[model samples]
Target: MLPLLLVPPALSTAFALAPVRRPFAAAAAGWVVSLPALELPVHTGIGVAAVTAGALAVGPVTTADRVGTGLAALTCGGLAVVLARHRAAARVLDRAFEGFAGSGAVDTTTRTTARNRTPWPTVLLRPWPVRPRSIRARRGLVYGPDPRANRLDLYTPRDGGRPRGVLIHIHGGHFRAGGPSRESRAMLFDHALRGWASVSTTYHLSPTPEAGFPQHLVDIKRLIYWIRTEGPRHGIGADAPIVVAGSSAGAHIAMMTALTAGDPRFQPGFEEADTSLAGAIGLYGYYGRLGAETKDISDPVRHPADGAPPVAVIHGTDDMYTPVKGSRRLERHLRAGSSNPVFYAELPGAQHGFDAVQSPRYLAVVAAIARFTEPLAG
Candidate 1:
């Protein structure tokens, strides 16, 4: 009972209420509060076992307590079913972009079994890899005037190269507390190993410095221009393809930028510069607006038009932060509105930020990304 109180029941209750906003320190627990809800089989098994043993030792609680226990049990069963379905995410990827490589090209048919295979059932629930070998990052290049706020980190293969494709990653913390070098390091390193350059960037957070509107977008646009002008010193050519990728709030920004490429309102001085992206990838993003529709670009789904770049969207069906329903909406709009293809994959039982580390499921998504952006390579 005590274990159950601390885990599924407690976390699930918080998730139901949905209170992970603002003055972030007070809301910090909501961050990790989501993990157990998605990976409930293990937590539920232990919790149920502990409760049963304790019940045998010290019998009978109130009717209300019994009712609570029954509800928790039901929750466990539902979570288990959802967890079982999560394995189908790879198939979702396969179906979404059947012609990713070329027309009539088949991908991962031989690798399908291997892609979803894991050494154990609880492999993903275990700790993730911290340091991947032969990956190097150059940290803290002063791209903007504010040193602490306007720095970026660049990652490349240990041997390195002037790769034709570059992935620019944006970190997510509700537009509050996260730096460029956090969360998606594993994804960046894996891209680097595949002979692609990866960038993790920092931009201004919202609602503290100013309202969460034009400032954040402006800073990102500035970074895009900087890379276009100065990318060659590190080997990204002027014509090289750029794919913008982000998770959570960062995903919203990535999708919005891809939808509204180079509107003068977002890019002040560099209004005329080439701010086009080869592709856009969103991981568990919400396309809601911050301010009044100051520009025509209010939300990605609302503003999506024809001729946008191809997009890859990955979301967890179990995600509560940015609901899977929202990703579904974005996917439908992109498919209907954009001239290029929109590939969407939904992991069944995974929660938000599931790919922050290295695991079989995540690496599979990384492979999907490799395929999605393959057409964009210059």
Candidate 2:
């Protein structure tokens, strides 16, 4: 009875350890032999030993039951020895490969070349619109805890009654470089001209290894939360609809934030309550299908299962970094799953970053975004 009780647990552990291999065949044969010897203790002991031996030869076994106790002990001991040997072999191979490749010398040359490359030319230009009285410029920190983190320049429309809407602008730097001051000043001017308060935020760059993956995302989310909560004090109404707009990496973060709208990790305040965004606009944004195998997609915030806000995606067909296909894929997925509106526009010969800085063709893309938000703002 005790030996019979052990068979299920032993088989379960074996299957779990060696999912692709069939270890159950040996166990079944042993069980058949044991059935005939059930009456005698000596015969039962021999039968149990046979099954244990078969299990040990096949795969990992658990010792919770008496049937495969010895087999489980031996398998665990063998695994430890095998793991130790693999670690030693890996170290030896790594050292040999490093010596042959001369990694240290190669890395130094690469670093030197990167350092000497010219930095991206950046300039900040503020164009005061004809209605200068309706726009006011002020500098403020989004996440007040971090002093070195990016500061936001807030341009509020001064119509004297209340803000019609708010547009939060995030500047793209490929997650490494670029500041909001230069990349988004033109957009801010446009927003002010349209009588909408605009915010341009600067975030930290990836100069150090620690600043690489998700730190920029955290900074952006913090900025959004601050704007949502504190905009009322600056004359922007609390209930005023907010539109998040970004280009390139900025667009990527904005899309991620929208996808993770109700997730507590991204927005704790919105977890228990409704935190649906008014709208989201992404220019040449990168979007990844869940579970799709791709090297470009990295760590992402947990997305809400409910739904995402209405999104307008614009991408140039010739964009090298975040292709138009990515935006198209997102539009298809969003439209199929929810009632929220998704708009996609593909520009023909334009490359990445064309819409941010003005070009004759890129003006049309900007006009599309303006049109999408005009109805909501009104």
Per-candidate TM vs. native?
A: 0.77, 0.58
Give the Cα error of residue 363 in candidate 2, in Å: 2.1
lDDT of 1 by residue, 1-378 (tens): 444453555555445234464445534456566555444444554565566456645756756456556766665665555445545666777666665546522243346566556434434454354545677778897666677777899887677667768888888888887888686776777677777788899888865322667677777778788888888887778777888999888888888788778789888878997888888989888776654644345567778558578888898765656778888888888878887877888876566777665444565677677777666766
**Number of clashes in every candidate structure?**
0, 2
lDDT of 2 at 137: 79
lDDT of 2 at 131: 26
Deviation (Å) of 156 in candidate 1: 0.4
Cα lDDT tens digits, model 2, 84-163, are 32223223322322432332211222232232222122111211112256578787655545666657888876665576
TM-score of 2: 0.58
Runs with alpha carbons beyond 4 Å of true place in candidate 1: 1-31, 37-83, 99-110, 119-126, 208-210, 293-296
RMSD of 1: 5.3
The TM-score of candidate 1 is: 0.77
Residue-level lDDT for 366 in candidate 1:
72
- Candidate 2 ranges beyond 4 A from true positions: 1-134, 207-213, 268-275, 289-306
